[model samples]
Target: MPNALPWLDAAPVLAACAAVAGFLRPRRGTAEVFLVGAGPGDPDLLTVAAVKALGRADVVLYDALVGPGILDLAPKSALRVFVGKRSGAHAMAQEAISALIAARAAAGKVVVRLKGGDPMMFGRAGEEIDHLKARGIPVTVIPGITAALGCAASAGVSLTRRGVAATVHFVTAHRCDAGATPDWSRLADPEGTLCVYMGKEQASAVRGGLLAGGLDPATPVLAIENGTRPDERRVSGPLSALPDLTAALGGGPALIIIGWAVAGAEASSPVSAALAG
Candidate 1:
C-alpha cells in the first residue's frame, strides 16, 4: 500500500499552487504621468514617444475625441478610464478628473492622459500640468499630429501659402464662458486663414462674426469632419454659406477653415465631387 500512489487528493496541492502564484506576482504601481496626444483619428499618426508611453501605462485616462484604435496600444492589463467630453456630455468634470489623475499618480501608478490632436492645442494640458505639478508629480508630454494639419493634408489644402494666405491663425469658436466673445475684428483678414476648433455648433455665430467684421462674404470656407479618418469628408462654400456647410457635416468633430487658401485648394485640387452642393 506504500507504493499505491494514492496518498493525497488534489486539494492541498491546488492550495499550495495558489499560494505560490500570489507570492510570485509582480508588484504594481509607479510614480509617473504621461500626457500623450492620440492625433486626430488615425493611429498611424501617433508619435513614437506616444506609443512608448502607452505601452508602459498602468492606467490610461483618454478623451472622447481619441479613437478606439489608439486605445488598443495600451497593455491588456492597463486600466482604461473614459474621461471624455462631448458637446454637452462630459463623463466627468475637469476638476474631478484632474483630482482623480493626481490622486492615482500620488498612489504611485504609471498614468497616461491620452487626448486627441496635439495636447497643447486646446487639450487643456496646461490645467492638468498645473494640477499634477502642485502635488510634485512627474509629468511627461508626447505630441501627435493635430486635426488642423491632418485635415489640411487629407483635404489637399494649405493653411498658408506664399501670397494667397500670408498668415494662418487658429481659434476656438467655443467660448470659455457665456459672456465671452472672440475679437472677430482681428480675425477678419480675408488674406489670412482662420482655423476654428470646436466650431460646428456655433457656425451661425462664426458666420455672423466674420461677416460683421468686414471679412469678404465670398471668402471660401471649408469644413472637414473626421479628418484623416476613412469616413473623412470635406464641405466647402463661401463664408456667407458657412452655416449650411457646417450643417451638412452633421454630428462629428470638425474644423472650420476660412480664407483664400480654401479657394486656392478647390481651384487646383481634385476633391470628391459628391462633397460639392
Candidate 2:
C-alpha cells in the first residue's frame, strides 16, 4: 500500500504456484492455466512473471479493460478471445465465461485469463478459481500493479505520505445490486487515505456519505481518469464538488484518491492543470 517497495505486496497475494514461463524451456506434459493481471492500462506495468505466462499461453481469455499492444506478447499462433462485457454487452455471462475456460483447459490447452487490474482485487477471479478447482484444472495466479499505485506515482499523488497519511484503505464505490453500500462513516480517517475503485458512477453517494460521516466538506478529493496511459487526465476539488468532477470526466475508467494527502497537489503526469480549467 505504501509507495516504496510496492511490489512487496504483489509477491504472495492470491498466488501460490510456480509460473509457466517464457521460451527458455518448452511447456511440459501438462498444460497449465494462468490468472494474470494486466495492470491499470499500461503494458509496461506488467510484471516479469505475467509476461512469461503470456508467452506460454495457448489461448488467452481477456477482459475489456486490457489495453492495446499487450496481446502481442502471446505466441503468434495462440488464440485470443475477448470475453468482456463491452464486447458482448450482456450476451456473455460470468457462468458462460467460466465454462469456456473449463472447456479449453479440459482439451489440454494453456489458458491465460487476462484481467484489467489485479485478479484478486474485484476481478471476479475467485468465482473463476472455484470453477476451475471443481473441474480439476491446474491454475496459477500473477499479480500486477493496481490502478491506485500506478496512478499515484504517474499523477504525483501520494495515497500514503509520512506525517500526512499513514493508513490507506481501498474501497469500492460500485453500486451494489444487493446489500448495503460501504459504510462511509466507519471508513473516514483524517490521518488516512481512501482509494475508491470503480467509483465514478456513484460519486454523489460517496460525497454524501463522507460528509454525513463527519469528513469536512472542504476535504480534498483528487481523481485520475485513464491513469498511467498517455491520455490520462486529472480533476481535483473539495468533497462537495464530486458531482461536477464525475460528470466532467471522459468515459474512460477512473479511480478516486480522497484525503488530505492529495490536497491542492499539482499532478506530476501530463494531467489537467486545474480542476476548473
Candidate 3:
C-alpha cells in the first residue's frame, strides 16, 4: 500500500543519510600553535591578540613569570601545564619544554607557549619556534610587553629621556653560557641608560662591576621587583646600595635600571623613601 505520509515513508533512510553525512564531516581537529607573550607579571599589559589566544588555547604551557592572574583567563576545561623555569629553582629543561609543545601540537591539540614579557625578549622563544618549524608544526608568534619597559613605566622612569640618554642598552644579568662575563666597561657608560634583566640576585656584583668601570658609586639605580604586578615594589638607591635595598624588600623577579635619566627621576618616585625606610 502507498504510504499516506510522504515524510514518514523515507524516515529510516533519511536518518541513515544524516548519520553518514555526520561521519564524513567529522569535526576537524584544531592543532594551532601560538607562541604568545603574557607580559611581565601584569595581565593588564597583555595585548588583545594575546588575550584572545589564551582564550582559545586547548593546552597552555606557561612560564613562571606569566603569573597566576593571567592563567585564570583560560577556560577551566583547558589543560594548564607548568613548564616554567624559576629564578633560583631548576625545573623542566628548555629543550624538553620545546619538544613537548611540538609533540602536543602534532597530536592535534591547540598549543599555547605562554611566556613572560615579549616572546622574543629573552623568552627562549626562538628555540621553541625553530623546534616546531623543524617538525612541520604550524606556529605563530605574538609579542608582549617586556619587563624593562613595564618596570620603567610603572616607576614613571623613562628608559630614554631626550638630551639625557641618546642610547639605551638592555642586558641580561645571567650569562648565556655558564661562565661568560659581560664587558662592564662598555656597559658603564654615563651617556646611556642600562636596563638589566635577571640581575637582582647579582646586585652586588653588578654594582661593583659598574663602579670599577667608572660608573659612579653614587649613580642612581632603581631595582623593581614583581614589576607591573599588584605587589610591584621599587627601591631606588645609589648603585653601591642596590643589593642591600633589594635584599631588604625580599627578592622577586626584578629589573635593574642605571643611568643619569634614572637618577633625574627622583622627584616622581617614592621608592627612594621606601628604600631609605
Against the reference, the lDDT scores of all candidates come to: 0.83, 0.81, 0.81
Residue-level lDDT tens digits of model 1 in 154-227: 88988888888898898987766786768877789988999999998888888888888899888888888888
Error of 1 at 101 (Å): 0.9
Q: What TM-score would you give candidate 2 relative to the actual structure?
A: 0.85
Model 3 per-residue lDDT tens digits across residues 1-277: 9668856667789998887554333134745688999888878889877877787778999988886699888888889999888665656988899888987888888788999999999888889888988888878788899999998988888888788888999898887587676776678988799999988677787888898889987778888888888787777877777887667655578888998788745423465765544
Q: What would the TM-scores of all predictions be?
A: 0.85, 0.85, 0.84
- Write down the lDDT that model 2 would get: 0.81
Which residue ranges in model 3 land beyond 4 Å of their true spot? Answer: 1-27, 264-277
Best by lDDT: 1
Better of 1 and 2 by lDDT: 1
Name the runs in model 2 displaced over 4 angstroms.
1-29, 86-91, 267-277
lDDT measured at residue 144 in model 3 versus the true structure, 0 to 100: 92
